[model samples]
Target: MHRLPPYRLRRSARAKYLRLLIRPEGIEVVAPDGLPESTVLAFVRQHSGWAQAKLAELQARLAKLRQGQAERFPAEGGSVPLEGRETPLFIEETGGSRIRVSLEDRGLRLILPRACGAERDRYVRDALFGWMKRRLPGRVAECVQRHGPQHGLYPRQLRIKSMRTRWGSCGPANDVNLNWLLGLAPPSVLEYVVVHELCHIRHRNHSRDFWELVSAHLPDWRQERQWLKTHGGGLIQRFDPVFP
Candidate 1:
């Protein structure tokens, strides 16, 4: 039998089955309480190849994250993504309680309190999200209006919220819920998620019919989806602290 490498083990009362997680720090095993240590070791050995591959992937992702951390937000001259393009963020003190933001010459200018302290990042994040909330509905509505008629699907209600694990969801009564995080993705990626959820109105599940409908409208949706899968984590990591 192959000896299992050293790994952290956690027992969970609510866990129904054993699970392995590869993290930046190391591999962690989560098992139900009272699971025998020998069984855990056997499971680790059974999936050693998968565990090794996942560990390497985690290392690569951590390296990318460390590189990305150098690019912080709300600095004197930082950059923020707007519709997938990197636009310059300019901060100017206006000596007022109100924070104002504007777009000019392909850049974003923020007019904010001159004496903003530690809360400045929070203020900027809130203001930017406010702007996105006000603007995203219209953008989503436009995408729906453009594509809904073709697929014979229209949502009765569209709701936007901050989500942790999903980009969008389709619910009863033809309601579609979109994550505010979509604003951070490229416009094409956001459209893909919108079309994806809208297709659910026709086919309730991720069945062949649902994907066919999505493909009929956006042929290059796979590329957009892949882009989200690869780059979306950074956006979420960057803003999660603000939202949390």
Candidate 2:
């Protein structure tokens, strides 16, 4: 553990509605409409303890996320899940940088380059993204078609992007966005998420109406949602890991 360092707080007006931001750079006080400088300073002084704790929590979470990224896929003798079974990862010395994956009774064997390192990580990440892009649209469309008919909700377009905090989003006038990370989850969980977003086409918010719509398609939505929140982070490993 590192010792806590003394911090110099600065007042900044760039924050939209957040009251305080305690980034590693420094503390930034978001100037709310009509809030006096003295009041904001006083608030900062009183809540210094809370800010430090929040910073500590963020640091710990970052460490955990990084650890997860490093171990996302299996290394030599490492194990990952296929369907519900445990499988071992075997690395072979392939001539080039390409990864060739094969699943067998021994689990999954991933052929790696003799010089595997950061470059190899990037290759795996790109491969995962490509697989997701190719497969997600049809699954998303299936969920949309099954549920959209009931509410006269039809989507104009469907796209996949890496999102920081959102699972999926429903834009105005029936545009839908899904997180590419959906590929890492199980088929049932992925289907649940797709249906959840499609329901938003009819009802935009997480209000009762929106939930009712989701429930109509997936009666066990709450279970799936909980699974995503608890285990979803496990699926969040990247070969070329990036964090914000």
Candidate 3:
């Protein structure tokens, strides 16, 4: 028999019988309380065909998303979305070891020391990314204070950094980590991310109660989340350029 995708068996008291559910995380097998491990495996084996088909669909969807993302990467000296606007980029080489990215009246002004080809690209990428990080803490501090009190959740510390695969994460220690790329997204998107992480401070898991809390604050969170899934990939690839 063909094996199923990665799955975990859960014993739920509310489960009347063994049932297989496909979720974003993976396949979940909910068995009635006191079901033996062997019985759960047998139940999963019977649904292998169904689970494999579903996961293959997921793979196809992911591949399509990546293909769409590839078409959106911003080229150097090209425009990129900054603060919800398509900001132009300008690069200039000057004599010095100083590398800086500045926002001028026209667009972003990148000052690079004598560098060429791949080296130049690296400097441009790093300077823009570093500038974004430095600019994020102040941008988000007000947001945290604005939303934290209403929900009664306050993070002990707030940090903004580059996380390739995550938008934000709330640690158990009451520290919230927001992605630096969020500074490029619209203010609404940034606000949504802040609220999401703040909610995590109270609800560690995405149970029904957790989602209710999220919905209460941001009724349109699903829309913002979908936007991230579709457009966020391009931003990620833009920051992570291949150098050889």
Candidate with maximal lDDT: 1
Q: Better model by lDDT, 1 or 3?
A: 1
TM-score of each: 0.67, 0.59, 0.67
* Weakest lDDT window of 10 consecutive positions for candidate 1: 235-244
Global lDDT of model 2: 0.68
The candidate, 2 or 3, that scores higher on TM-score is 3
- Model-by-model lDDT, in order? 0.83, 0.68, 0.82
Q: What is the lDDT of candidate 1?
A: 0.83
lDDT of 2 by residue, 1-244 (tens): 3333445544446644437677755555666566676776676777777888888888788889867755865556666543224557565767776666666676656666767665655555555456567767887787777777877777788998777577788788677788777755666777787888777777778899889888888899998898888976666643224622
* lDDT value, residue 45 of candidate 2: 70
User: What range of 10 consecutive residues in model 3 has the weakest lDDT sum?
Assistant: 68-77
TM value for model 2: 0.59
Q: Tens-digit lDDT track for model 3 on 1-244?
A: 5665679888899999899887756788899999888998887888888897897788788888866544444445577678768898888888878888889999988888875545776677778788988888887888888877887988889988778888999998989999888988888889889888889998998898888888888899899898899889877777655555
Order of quality (TM-score) = 3, 1, 2
Flag the better candidate by TM-score, 1 or 2: 1
- Candidate 1: the clashing residue pairs are none
Question: Which residue pairs clash within candidate 3?
Answer: none
Question: What does candidate 2 score in Cα RMSD to the true structure?
Answer: 14.6
